[model samples]
Target: MGVVNVTQSQPVASMPEEDRKLSFREKVAATIGNMTGTMHNQIIATFLLFFYTDILEISPAYVAGLFLVARIIDAILVPVFGVFVDKVSTPWGKYVPYFAILGVPIAIFGWLTFTDFGLGANGNVIYVTATYLVYSILISIKYAPSNAVGPAITKRIDDRISMGQIGYIAIMLGALFASLAFQPLYKALGNGNDARGFSLIMGLVGLVGILVSIFQVTSLKERYINPNNSQKTPLKEMISAVFTNRSAVVLYIYVLALNLSNGIRTAIMIHYFKYFFNNEGLVVIYGAVSILPTFLGVMVSGPITRRFGIKINVLAASVVNVICMLSVMVIPDTKAGIIIFMALNAITAFFLGASTPAQGSMMPAAMDYTEWKTGKNVNGLMGSIQGFVQTLAMALAGSIAAWALHVVGYVPGVEQSSETIFGLKLLMGVLPAFVLLFTASILWFDISEEKQKQITKELAERRQQKS
Candidate 1:
């Protein structure tokens, strides 16, 4: 119970900042907070595309273009958010303030994004476009500061990796719970209307999400960030620092690919199960079967990375993903094939979850390198780059799902042709496998743990010298 009496006023300043690993309570608090903060995004990601194309009768191409536009705007604005986060200073601390300020709005906008206003087709599109753009922008703003807090909390690479592992459990758990409950919750609330169900359930979940995110302010602290460094790095300089750092570029691409893969798989998941398998309920079962293996993968990630190194674990996950995804095509379209598909999904889920920690830790490691190289602690700006990659990836993936659906001749509430069936599988299985190739760029990321150790030591010494 190494709990410090941390309040908004003196968050983390009481603790000696140098290489300060978090307490057990602090770690638990961070995990729970992260789980809550991410819930809205999970809801949107897991079901929104399906909601748009299937329930609302929006054209798949239009839906795809809409998703793409929102995320593209988000991608561009995220770095500006990073710069804004860096420029701002307050008594509560740079990162913590965002959680408190944006918490309620995130929930509100999230629920709004899921809403189906009975406006005619034109009104619905206009309303949706406006709400989604607002929600998309807020997510980028919230996550910019939210992600910056991790690096601010500590400079220890092991702690960063450990936190990432724990954080991923929260991420997957949020998704698992959302996937499991969305159908039942919506149906019960809306009396069999999917639009009504999705809207009501998201509202309830958003309320809970905001409360937990706000409570996070009291448990976590921003120890490493200099409260007094009010000098804002120009956007041009922020861009230069991030691009010039080889590891940052690699990690950005890594983030983009990983997020894009997840976006495509999830955005099109309901369509796959509902049409291709004619068993939409299998979505919940898929989430259930994925739990044990995915959690086990997360549990083993720390040990695996420590023993074999992060690069190898990430590469291995990528390779496993390709093999398992491609193997899905060979499964016969029968009841037995469902079990085989799920089993393959479980294997893929495990590796994807396993690689999360190794993947997430790279961002902060890259940030440290940037700070060392430029003598500028632009953690907020750098964290936005991570967010930017995700925005861009999701943008592309969302559009890909829609375009593929439209091209393949998908129609709601009808029997699909074999070609459409093949197209669905390709979007779900093959496209994600291809996106995982983005990891090849990571081969150039030579920032080993040993390398990080020296950078950590040198940065600390330099900070001490400056003080």
Candidate 2:
């Protein structure tokens, strides 16, 4: 519904590979890029908070504030960087250089984020926060541009849909890879002292991830960068268009909730399984099993979406996520609890993957709508907000988990009080369920299938005119 004013300047055009379908090899390469991008973050998300609380001995409340403040800073930077991407280019490419060149710094900062050089409690607070912020900046540079790559790869719906599943599959693979390697490497390197082990583990693993990224990214091409977008389409107008597109707004809502819920759950899982379930090792099982279904879901999502359409695909995924999380509200003490919880958790992960392609398609669709309306591409600006949503949710998740720990009287490496145990249940289960359900409700307002067909037709004609 938001109309961008483009009368002031005309957009210069290039050949956009909007309709080109990727080959199997190209898809594999992109999947590698997506996988590598996810692995380092998954490492941080899975273990950094636990390290902060248990190893560094930072206060939970202060840790909460630390994460939240970084998010606030990240929120501001995401937009600035978004506009920067929209307005700038490099010899390497518009979006490619950010990931290709910046990958080294990202790995370095990622290592630094986990390293502790005898920083006292107060010093650790400052040091950890600084490293985290730098890491965030490097990630923002890499991730914002990377987000645009999928849309750039191809504009065909079926490809986007398949790419979505592939993208999510890649993400889960990264997370799974992190989970498998993280526990063993840290424990082995540290000689049972995880705090000391992480610096070594992160540095080594992060380097490998970055290397894979370089190989993967260089193999790919950016066929869709519109060189004149920034010259003609002002930043203000592009930002305005993001809000006016209801589908984009829906994306914002969905991402915020999705990231927040997942973050809270991820940030708390080590604690949840260890203290509440009295089976700390189950955390590894938890990681493996929860992500296992993603592959199956990805395989089936294409057929499912073609049959049901995108709107229903996304809605059903979120709704089932709610149900699965709700079923996890109470963890029983018997062996049956482990079996039951893992089963439900797998289902939750399945939907998460099943809906991924559909979810992935939404942002590109929203971007196309904006371009259709204004004849300008603002993928960079839109991608930044999506990245920001992840950061914002991660920030809130850390803060909330820490705050909840305080409320629950959670003491590290001790038998938790009954209230603490119950609180963990609610934090991991009830909270995320409700958040996801709220996210699903926003689906009703999304752009309908018929509307999308019309938009696609009109945009194709417009592109032909420019060609």
Model 1 per-residue lDDT tens digits across residues 150-235: 76777777787788888988887776676666667788999978888888888898888677766678888876666645365566
**Model 1 weakest lDDT span, ten residues long:** 1-10
**Candidate 1: which stretches are off by over 4 Å?**
1-17, 45-69, 108-133, 186-206, 228-232, 267-280, 405-425
TM-score of every model versus the real structure: 0.82, 0.82
Q: Kindly list the per-residue Cα lDDT of model 2 for residues 301-334, writing each as its tens digit.
A: 9988889988887888888877877776765856
Model 1, C-alpha of 399: deviation from truth (Å): 1.9
- Itemize residue pairs with steric clashes in candidate 2: none
Q: What are the C-alpha RMSDs, in order, of all predicted structures?
A: 6.7, 4.7
